[model samples]
Target: MSFHTPSDMKLICGNRNYSSWSLRAWLTLRKAGIDPELIVLPMDTPEFEERIAGYSPTRRVPVLWMGEEYVWDSLAIAETVSERYADSRLWPADSRLRALGRAMAAEMHSGFAALREELPMNCRARQRRLTCSDNAQSDVQRVSELWQTARQQSGSSTWLLGDFSIADAMFAPVAVRFNAYALDLPVPAQAYVAHWLADADLQEWMSLANKEAWIIEHEEVGE
Candidate 1:
């Protein structure tokens, strides 16, 4: 009956293979060093819809169940935890950096529709030259600009805003899209994607995804 944990937290997520939203929330939690009870639900599993009812009224994955409050949606959960744990550096420390970070993250949450539709996340798929449509290409260009500007503005830190903040979590799906579709990137975007691809959490997530037996036919790319 309770997804909330004793003190840390509990995060209910969807299958690693297709749940981009879940990845966003999970990355934020992992970055914050809050070990939540991770419960993975298969996207197409009839049980998934029924099971998620425990997390929130929305019956969606990436729901964070805290002590007394429940947060639905990936971005909302990220903000909630950030408010609770500032030491986690969920948002950029500086006001300007935070503003820019929110702008970029908002783009990630709301934009890139074409790219997302074209290149759904498939961790096991080895797509060396998957071609995206023109709309998807435009999305890629915009994403590349975002990466370059954020990386340039961040002073000494290695992440988007000098530290691995919510900005990085926001663009996590874009990184997957580029890798999934094998989209060619400019120098700066390519470098940023490279580091993101090599991330341990991403690697582990992909590895686990590859082993999953479940698959939603709609999300599967045409071979």
Candidate 2:
């Protein structure tokens, strides 16, 4: 079925320079063909936390408001929209493929702490790839392995499961992190990153993020 015109949805997000989780949720909604209003909060501002209390139960960004439903957390938002709009094909159709997709997205939601903390998404800056702490390196290796395994198993598909799914949306911010930090990936993973970087929507996001006047000092990754 055609999704409720995404144009009607509203997505609340934090600063584009800092909120990777928010990016994940926003991209999922957009790819689902939902034209949600992008609500951005200045992470450094005192009102940031205060403002979120009304819309976000967790007091974080990337909150999804669909009609009366309030979805918090990036992964939850994606799943909610996908299930609500079956035609979006947010997950694969085959049972096993769908299961793998969920597994990947779950892994992303709960794991990869080192990479997330060390290389947080900073859309306004590009830094040379340099020393990664053991923890961060381990996370990077694991992500590359995930992508490799998924590509090999999926065969003809360009994404984790032959087509764009929640798995890709979950990893999308990570992909941006890799690019922003100039982290080189394994050859196959490098190719995947290339695909992600070339996407027009991502490019547009980067452009807007760079143009935004707000700056959150806490999220700045490098000098």
Candidate 3:
């Protein structure tokens, strides 16, 4: 029943093609050059519940197993990694920029409900010309505004922060979602998404996602 491994570090998540939260944690760890052994579970299966129940109290994916210790939420996993590797600048080194990144990350973690609900992450899909609600459009604009403001406030960088911080990880899934749904983003947000998609590690994750066989019924939207 234990997703726990003898290895000190492991990441337990669901199918890469459909799990946005899992992608967040996985991308963060990969960005930090920490390749934790990944345990992927098939969604909508009793086996998934039985296995993940051991690592997660919330009965969810993206649980980080640090040997006997485990971290359950994606944000918590990012924070744990950041704290463990402070010198790695998981958060920006500049205090002001760090605060701003945290704020953005927190917003990504909790807000954008409409955008998320409307455009669920589907890595294999090449959907285009999809209809979106006003609320979803507003959510997209808010994300664009946040990215534009973060870039303006921090000057120039590929990531939201001046460097690749946890903030980038927080928004990585959004980039994938936008790309998957063919959502047109504003200039700043478009550039941000482009930069992340070009990342080698992210490309690798997407490659793996494309190879997965199991499909979640809910994630197979719009045919």
Candidate 4:
């Protein structure tokens, strides 16, 4: 088997309905004015298992291929895009705010395992019911706290850090999870969720997700 590198940037992702990490990287790229060649491989499929190895050493979705170079992780992809497209202002101009945003994004990347597992991202689903574990609830609260902190620190009511930075991209999937499950949240957090839901790019992603036919049962939680 042979792999051919594209002359332009390409992103290999999993299903839009279930792949939160894919959403993060894809949204980051879009925010940076990059419309890469998209390759969607439905999760838990033979095609994904067979083809992923060629694109990613970790065998994961959301691998970004920039010619021969590949970024296999979502946060790394965001960082790379920010560096390469500095004019895009993926990070804020203020050094303090940028540091805060990086910390928040990193937390979202490395933490929140329980919230992630219990409230799997199902973009096409809404008002679903699920009894979350204590850890999951705690994770949700922490996310809310992070958002509130970002808003308070940046003095921005719209997006975290006063603009749509990589931090917002990182937390975009969490907004989906909150909306899908109708999770009870504080007023500020709920407002942030509403803001994210109204985003055109997120709406487009969900529209595509709703049209997809592949269904991974294990991720089909909540009724």
Highest lDDT scorer: 4
Q: Residue 103 of candidate 3: its Cα lDDT? A: 91
What's the lDDT of the predicted structure labeled candidate 4? Answer: 0.91
TM-score, candidate 2, is 0.92
lDDT (Cα, 0-100) at 125 in candidate 1: 65
Ranking of predictions according to TM-score: 4, 3, 2, 1
Write model 4 residue lDDT over 1-223, tens digit each, in one string.
1233335889999999999999999898877777778999989989889999889889998999987788889999999888886474999999999999999999999999999898999998898988999999999999999999999999999999997899999999999999999688999999999999999889989999999999999898998
User: Per-residue alpha-carbon lDDT of model 2 for 1-223, expressed as tens digits?
Assistant: 2334555578899877678888888777777766678888878678887888888778888888877878888888898878876474988887887888788889999999889888888877775465778999899899999988888878833788887889998998888888778665788887788788887767878888888888666676665
Can you give the TM-score per candidate against the true fold? 0.90, 0.92, 0.93, 0.95
Model 3, 124-182: lDDT tens digits are 87654578899999999998898888888889668887878888888888888878876
RMSD for each of the candidates:
3.6, 2.3, 3.8, 4.3
Give the per-residue Cα lDDT of candidate 3 at 153.
Answer: 83
Task: Give the better candidate number (2 or 3) by TM-score.
Answer: 3
Runs of candidate 3 with Cα error greater than 4 angstroms are 1-6, 86-88
Q: Quick one: ranking by lDDT, best first?
A: 4, 3, 2, 1
> How many residue pairs clash in model 3?
0
TM-score for candidate 3, please give it: 0.93
Q: How accurate is candidate 2 locally (lDDT)?
A: 0.81
Residue 99, model 3: lDDT of 88
